[model samples]
Target: MGEVTEYVAGLHEPARSSIEGVFFIAREVVPDAEEGRSYGMPALRYAGKPLLAVMEAKAHIGLYPFSPAVIDAAADLLEGFDRTKGTVRFTPEHPLPEEAVRRLVSLRRDEIDAAIGRRRA
Candidate 1:
């Protein structure tokens, strides 16, 4: 199995399901994103840069968008969700909504695109 698949498979119920749901949203948002391990957790990359990562924590699942700006821009969508500078925390009982995941990925995609544009310019 691929690293992401293996990582997801290794997780127990609820966490496994939660991570899978995030993975599905990532695929939907960035069809070309490649899956692998980053920072010891399953992550997705686009255009050779980190897009998102998900890991099962002791009491919550963490979603990493790899950009504090993305988290800041998504404040509205993240209401009621516990978050740090770049990670959003949620419990299996209160997993992130698909729409919120979509917005987070979408914002991150835009950020990456902008960075690529800046580098090219």
Candidate 2:
């Protein structure tokens, strides 16, 4: 987005915007989270560990879902696109599917609750 930062740089606008959207939804879904930059991308932390991270790649942008629940919920969206537990790769030419984005955020909220419940248990 901008010049080389102390934490994150080497990112272009398309990737930067994609990361920004991911961060926006993540914050809405995971308020109270500690947000920061990691490896030149946005990272969301809960309980002192990574809950999610976003990065833009040359061919695609990656939205990393740290929760299995989010992946399962978005299985259909992953049918043809590149994917991983820590990444959902897509392109700036074709924006990440909006429905998929909402699903991810919804699932993440559930995952956070479940993890909190597990910790309490």
What lDDT would each prediction earn against the true structure? 0.88, 0.66
Report the lDDT tens digits of candidate 2 across residue range 46-112: 6555666766566777777676667877989777777776678887676667777768766765676
Instruction: For candidate 2, list the clashing residue pairs, or say none.
Output: 64-86
Residues 16-46, model 1: lDDT tens digits: 9889989998999899999876777678988
Query: Lowest summed lDDT over 10 consecutive residues: which window, candidate 2?
Result: 1-10
Candidate 1 ranges beyond 4 A from true positions = 118-121
lDDT, model 2, position 30: 62
Candidate 1, lDDT over the whole model: 0.88
| Model 2 Cα shift for residue 91 (angstroms) | 1.1
Cα lDDT for residue 34, candidate 1: 91
